[model samples]
Every structure is written in C-alpha cells, then in structure tokens.
Target: MKDTGRFFTVGLVAAWYSSNIGVLLLNKYLLSSYGFKYPVFLTMCHMTACSLLSYIAIAWMKMVPMQTIRSRVQFFKISALSLIFCASVVSGNISLKYLPVSFNQAIGATTPFFTAVFAYLMTFKREAWLTYISLIPVVTGVIIASGGEPSFQLFGFIMCVGATAARALKSVLQGILLSSEGEKLNSMNLLLYMAPVAVIFLLPAALVMEENVVGITIALARDDIKIVWYLIFNSALSYFVNLTNFLVTKHTSALTLQVLGNAKGAVAVVVSILIFRNPVSVTGMLGYSLTVIGVVLYSEAKKRSK
Candidate 1:
C-alpha cells in the first residue's frame, strides 16, 4: 500500500504537468482555430465538469476522504475563492485566444512576485529582503519578453496580467481562509466546494457575454465531433490539474510544489513555441530565461529564509 501510494503520487505530478499543458494548448486550439469564440462558456463547461467529477471522487471513489464546510461563514469564504478562480481561468482563456502560449506562459512566471505582494498586503506577512529583491529580474525579464514578443497584443497582455494577479490573490486568500487547522479543507474537498460555486458565478456572465452557446455547441457537434471531444478532454484535464495540485502538495512540501511550478512554466513555454512554431527573438528568449532563473532564485531565497 505504501509503495502504491508513492507511485501514485509521482504519477499525479506527471498528470499535473500533462493536464496543465494539454488544457492550455487545447483551449488555444479551440478558441483560435476551432472558432469556439466563447471563453466564458468554455470556462463554464470546465467548472461543470470539475464539479461533477470532484463530486464523484468524494462521494463514490472516496479518493481523498470527504470534507464539508462546517459553517455558513466557511461556505461563503470558499465561495469567494471560487469567484477568484473563475476570473483567473476566464481571463487566462481570453488571453490565450490572443497571445501565443509561449508568451502567455512567460508572463505567468511573474506569479510569485504577485503572490508575495498580495501575501504581505492581505496577511501582513513579511519575507526576507532578498526575496523581494530577487523579483527585480523577474519583472525586468517580463518587460523584456513583452517588448520582444513578435505576436504581442495589448488586450491579451492586460488579461494575462489580470489572470496572474487574480491567481496570486486566490493563493493568499486560500491561506487566510483555510489557515485554521479545524477549518482546513484538503485540495479535493476545496475543489468540490469551489467548482460548483464557480459554475454558478460564471453562468450569468457566460449568458450575457457569449452568443448562442447552444447554437454554437450544436453547430460544432454537427460539423466535427472532434471539437466536442476536445472540449470534454479539456474539462477533464482541468479537473486533473486541480486534483494533482492537491495531491502533489499532500505528498511533498510547498517548496517542492513551487519548484515544480517553475519547471512546468518553463516546459510549457518551450513546448508551446515548438508546437505552434511561434517566432521568438533571441532577446525574448533570453528575457524569458532570465525570468525563469529569477523565479528559481526567488524560490531558493524563500527556502533559505524559512
């Protein structure tokens, strides 16, 4: 049993990267080439899928052991996190529609900086000065990358930055909301609660912002079943991304998870460039490389401070 659990944990890490990259590319394909043109509706599908699959994992599979919010306050707190989650994903998808995945991933590398700033503001937590200084290269690299990006779009860049900030805020809020030992919910449990709430939050916006989702879905269904399959796969992978995030942190330390996140960002950028055949200037690549290196150093700084 111990060996099986270890193997599962390692596999979950792989699943995390696979799903993360897969969903990014799939969403790009769908929104760009496949002509989905409805980021909000697509996000709704993802949340619905996550909510259902997570429910099954808890109720039937008993994958992570069931957990429930004990009070209305806790429920509302989780719901607030759910709102942030929805905004992050919606903005990310919208950004992907306009920006190359490589650039998108490059911008995402600044998440740690945003996380640090939010943590200090929201939680009154302080880190070593070196930790803050390390972010200099992180911000500079992103600026260089943006300047050098051949396919940069102003709107896409703004949305991507928004997504990153929302993600950072979610991380800090999660820490505060779930800080108490008795109230802490495991990843799976949190997803189960959050995904459904996010769906509810997104539905009204999707309806208001998107055009004829039913008609578009039917058109795609008739024209190409492949698109529908991709949507399903994308949603399933989205849930796995959440699941593996929890599993990884359960089996390893937060620092290890952060390290993996850094690697994953680098891998996704390289893979996207290669797959999409996006033209990246030497300066841009160097900038992105510096950003990644800065992230690694920042992680190290945090570790040493701890």
Candidate 2:
C-alpha cells in the first residue's frame, strides 16, 4: 500500500509539471507566434473549458463528492475570487503576447514577495524576519533581469508584474474569504464553482475588449483547421493543469508543492528557451538564478519557522 501510494504521488507530480509547462508554452505560441492576439477571449475559452470539465469530473464521473455554495455569502466570496482569477489569467496571457516565456517566468518567481505583502496588509499576518529578508533577492533579481532582457517591452513587463501580484492577491484573499470551516471547499470544488463565475465575467469583457475576436478566430480556423485542434488541446491542458495541481496539493504538503513549483519554473525557463530560441543574456540568467535561489531560501525559512 505504501509503495502504491508513493507511485501515485510521483505520477501526479509528473502530470502537474507537464500540464503546467504545456499550458504556458502553448499560450505563448497561440498569442505570440500563432497570431491569436485575443488574450481575453482566449482566457474565456480556458474558463469555459474548466467549467465543463469540472462538471463532468465531479457530477458525471464522480471524481469527488458534488459540492455547492451553501449561502449567498459563500457565493459572493467565490465571485470575488473569480474576478481576481480572471485578472491574473488574462494579464498573464497578454504578457505572453509580448514577452518571452523565460522572462515571464522570471517575473512570476516574485509571487512570494507579493503574497507576503498582501498577507501583511490584508490579514495582519507576519512571517519570520528571515523570511522577510529572503524576499530582497526576489525583487532585486527581477530589476536586474529587466535591465538585461534584450527584447523587453515596458507594457509586457508591467502586465507580467500585474499578473504576478494579482495571483498573489488571489491566494491571500482565498485564505481570508474561505477560511471558515463551513465555507471551506476542496480545491476541485472551489475550481468547479470559480470557473463558471469567471466565464460569466469574462464573456462580456472579451466581447467588448477583443473586438471581433470570435470572427477572427473563425477566420483563422478556415485558413487552417489545425488552429481549432490547437485551441481544443490547449484548453484541455488548462483544465488538467488545475486538476493536477489540486491533486498534488492533496497528496503532499503545501511546502512540497512550493519546492516543486520552484523547480518547475526553472525547467519551464530552459524548455521555453530551447523551444522558442529566445536569446538569454548572461546577466538575465544570473538574475533569474538569484531569484530562484531566494525563493528556495524563503521556503526553507518558512519551514524552519513552522
């Protein structure tokens, strides 16, 4: 039984890594190289896919017990989370349109710094002094990386940073809004609800902001049928990314997830660079390395403090 459990966990971790990296690379391909410059609409597609898949998993397939919001307050809390999730995902897709995945991942590595800031401001949660100090390199590395990035765009950098901060904020807000035992939902259940709410919010925004994105996508499909297949595969991967992430967290500790996340970012950077042929300067590499090292240190500090 122990050996079987360990193997299952290893499989889940592998799936999590592959799906996470796959979704990111495909998002970059679709938005940047493939000329699908409709990030809001693309994000909407992702949410739509998640909504449908989560329903099938929980309702039809019985992956977990079906769950529903128990009160208006819980529904409102989920709505707030959905809004932040939309912002984070859309901004991230938009950033990929103008930035290399390597640079984007480097910017994303600073999520812990923002998470700490938001936690302190919103929840009055304070970490150990060592954990606070460890974030210095996380910020400094991004600044140094920005200076060295060869194809840096100001707008892309800003969007990427915004996405990172929004992600952190969502994490903090999730803790605050859903901390109550009665309100708490499992990750899959939370996603099942949040995905549909996100779609509800994203639909109008994409229609207004993206300006004929639907028509453009249809036209692209006519030109190459492969575009439709690419989108289907990409959207499916997005759902799997979330699913595997939840499974990994369920099976292992949050600290283990954090450590795997750090390694995943590094692996993603290398894979994206190789696949996209994005030029990386020595300074940029050094800065990214520094940021990753700082994150590892921060994780260690948190573990010791606990």
Candidate 3:
C-alpha cells in the first residue's frame, strides 16, 4: 500500500509538473506578446477558474466539509493573504521581462531560505542565526550560475528578490492561518475566499500599471496568432498549479513536495535555454546548480526538523 501510494504520488507530480511546464511556456509566450497585461489577466483568470473548479468538484463529488467560511473575518483574512500571494506572481512575471529565466529561477530558489527566516521571525518571534548562513551557499551558487552577465539590470534584480520575499511571506502566513482556521475550511471554501481577494487586489494594479502598456505591446507582437491561444491556456495552467499543489500535498509529505518543486528552477532554466537558445555560460550553470543544491539542503533540514 505504501509503495502504491508513493508510485501514485510520483505519477501525480510528474503529470502536474508536465502540465504546469507546458502552461507556463505558453504563459510566457502570451505575456511576452501582451506584456504585463497577460500576466495580470491570467492571474485573475487562474484563481477564479481554479476556485470555481474546486467548488464544482466538491459539489459534484459530494465531498465532506464543503469548505465554506464561517465568518467575514475569516474570509477577509484569507483574501488579504491571497492578495500578497497574487502580488508575488505579478512581481515575478514583471521581473521576467528584465531577467533571464535562469536568473529569475535562481533568485527564486531563495524562497526556502526566506521562508525559514520569515517562519522563524513571524511564527516563533525568534530568529534563526543560520538563516543567513544557509543563504551564503545559494547566493554563491546563483552568482556562479548567472555567468556574470554584464547586461543584468539592478532594478529588475531588486524586483525579483522582492518577489521571492513576498512568496516566502505568503507561505508562512498561509501556514499560520491554515494551522489555526483553514483546517476546517474545505478546499472550495478556501478558494471562495482566496480568488476574490487576489482578483480584487489585482484590479487596481492592472489598471494603474499594465493597462496602457499591454495594448501597445500586443500590437507589436501581433505577428503571432498563437499568442492568443497561449494566453488562454496559460490562464488555465495557472489554475492547475493551485489544483495540483493541493492534491499533491495531501497525498505526499511536505518534504516530498519541496523536493520535487526544487526542480522547477532547474527545469525552467533548461527549457528556457533550449527554447530561446540563450548564451548560458558554464559558470552560470555551475552557479545555478549550487543555488538549487543549497535550496535542497535547506529543504532537507526543514524536513528533518519537522
């Protein structure tokens, strides 16, 4: 039975990862065409679509604990946290315009380090002395992996790092909320609150930041009709990300999830390299490898502690 569950989990993650990669590739193409507009619009669609899907599944399947929020406060809390979650995506996507996927994913691997820091500070009110210690290897690895590109943008780097921080905060905060309250909340109920919160926050952001820019960008990329389909599929892909993460987590240990997710950075790099044929350097590959290795180590430490 244990072997069966493990095999199922592996298959589940493989399918989930393959689908997500396909979606993100299409998403990248769409956003590249429509610029930031596609990213914002896709995010909205992703959350709402996934949430609605979860709701329907729950109803059709007659699942227990239908996941309805008990109070306005609970709803607000989930939404508020989800808003931060949404921002992480926006920041990461926008940063992608400036940096290569290799650099972007390398920077993102720091989430484990950041999550540990935030969890320590926010949850325990105690800081880990080793958090910075653990970060050194990751930083070193990314630098080695980035191939010392002279064209790197400092501002973009800052935004990407900021996105990492936001993701880390979202993880710890969501964990805290779920620990106390979300356990009782069904999958559908969680979506009910999460989607609205994310979509609402993204609205003003899209209008203020991406609205005027997207039209002009799309016009330039108009040579590609496929971009439209890619954008829609990308939106669906975003939702699947949420769906798989939930399903995968329930079936496997958090450590197992972390282990598989570590591949996202490297796999993204390989795909981006082959797809774009970007000039990736040996040093850059080395650094990327190191960063991922450090992240894996941090995850192992976390798992052992848990």
Candidate 4:
C-alpha cells in the first residue's frame, strides 16, 4: 500500500509539472507569437473550457461526484474566489504578452512571500521569525532579477506581480473560506463553480477591454486557421492544468505541491530560455538562483516549524 501510494503521488507530481509547464508555454505562444492578442478573451476561453470539461467529468462521466454550494453565504464565498481566479489568470496572461516566460516565472517565484504576508494580514496569524526573515532574500532576489532582466517591461512586471499576489491571496482565502468540512468543495467541484462564475464576471470586462482585439484576431485567423487551433489547444491545456493540480493535491500533500511548484518555476525558466532563446545576464541568473534557494529555505522552515 505504501509503495502504491508513493507511485501514485509521483505520477500526480509528474502530471502537475508537465501540465503546468505546457499551459504556460502554450499561453505564451498563443498570446505573443500566435497573434491572439486578447488576454482577457483568452482567459474567458480557458474558463469556458474548464467549466465545460468539469461539468462533463462530474455529471456525465461520473469521475467525481457533484457538489453544490449549500447556501447563499457559500455562494458568495465561492464567488469571491472566482473573482480572484479571474484576476490571477487574466493578469498572468497579460504579463506574458509583454514579458518573457523566464522573467514572468522568476517574478512568480515570489508567490510564497505574498502568501505568507496575506495569511498574516487576513487571518491575523503570526509565523516564526525565521520564516519571515527567510523571505528577505526572496524579495531581494526578485528585485535583483527584475533589475537585470533584459526584457523587463514595467507594465508586464506590474501585472505579473498582481497575478502573483492574487494567486497567494486566493490560497489563503480558500483555506479560510472553505475550512468547514461540510461546506468545503473538492478541487474539481470548486473549479466547476469558480470557472463559470469567473467567466460571467470576465464577460463584460473582456468585451470592454478585448472585444475589438478578438475581432482583430478573428480577421487574422481567416488567413491562418492555426490561430484558432492554437487558442483551442491552449484552452484545453488550461483545463488539464486545473485537473492535474487537483489530482496532485488530493493524492499527495499541499507541501508536496508547493515544493513541486517551486521546482516548476525553475523548470519553466530553463525551458523558456532554451525554447524562446530568452537572453539572461549572469546577474539575472544569480538573482533567480537566490530567489529559488530562498523559496526552498522558506518551505523547509515552514515544514520544520509545523
């Protein structure tokens, strides 16, 4: 049984890493190179795919049992989560528009720091001094990396930071809002509710911000239908990311997921640099190294403390 559990956990981690990296690369290609310049609309497409696929998995395939929001309060809580999800995905995609995947991921390495800060602020929970102190290098490393980044754009950096912070906030808020066993929605069910709500929320925003942009994409796609296929594949990969994340978390531990996430950032940077030929200065590499080391240290600190 232990061996079986270990094998399953390993498989889940592999799936999570592959799907996460795949989604990032696909989104970067679609948004930047594929001429699908509408990030918000692209986000809506991702949400739509997730919503549809999740419904099928739950209702038709019977892969997971259906779960419904039990009350108005739960609905509102889940809605808030959906809003955060929308903000994170859209902003992250927008950042990818102007930023190299390497730099965007380097910036994303600050998620743990943001998560700690948000946890303290929102829950009034205190952490060990070491945990707080360990994050100093994490912040400093990202700043150094940003300074040394050749492709750094202010708008992209800002959006990436916002996405990172929103992601952290979502993690904290999800824990607090879904603490009750009876009221808690499993990851797949949560995705089902959250994705649709997010799509509804993003509809007007996408129309206002990206409707014309999408129209332009459609016109461009007529000459090259590859654009449409890229968008569809990208959206499908986004759903795969959600599915893998849930499977990994459900089968393993959150700590395992966090550790894998840290590794994924490094993997993303390496893959992006190799595939996209992103130029990185020695100082930038050093800075990214520092940030990753700090994150690993912080994770260890949190684990030991617990």
TM-score of each: 0.95, 0.98, 0.84, 0.95
lDDT of 4 by residue, 166-244 (tens): 9999999999999998788888999999999999998899889875766787787899888888878888889989888
Better of 1 and 2 by TM-score: 2
How far residue 144's Cα lies from its native spot in candidate 3, in Å, is 3.9
Query: Model 3, range 1-306, lDDT digits (tens) per residue?
Result: 999988988888976787766665655555553454446656666766666666666667654346667678777668767878788877777676677776777888888767867977888754344544656788788666555643367876887888999998987887777767435464445665677677778766766766665575476458776655665666667666766777887788767778789886578778877775657667777777888878876666555544
Global lDDT of model 2: 0.95
lDDT of 1 by residue, 1-306 (tens): 999988887898898999889889899988886788899989999999999999998899988789868999999999999999999999999998999999999899999999999999987899999999999999999999999999999999999999999999998999999889878988788989999899899988987888678687888799888878888888998998888788788888888898899999988988887788989999889899999989999999989998
Task: Indicate whether candidate 2 or candidate 4 has the larger lDDT.
Answer: 2
Off by over 4 Å in 1: 1-10
> In order, what lDDT does every prediction score?
0.91, 0.95, 0.70, 0.90
User: What ordering of candidates by TM-score runs from best to worst?
Assistant: 2, 1, 4, 3
Order the candidate numbers by lDDT, best to worst. Answer: 2, 1, 4, 3
Tally clashes: model 1: 0
For candidate 1, the lDDT comes to 0.91
The predictions' CA RMSDs to the true structure, in order, are 1.7, 0.9, 3.3, 1.7
By TM-score, the best candidate is 2
The number of clashing residue pairs in each candidate reads 0, 0, 6, 0
Put down candidate 2 lDDT per residue, 81-158, tens digits, no spaces: 999999999999999999999999999999999999999999899999999999999999998999999979999999
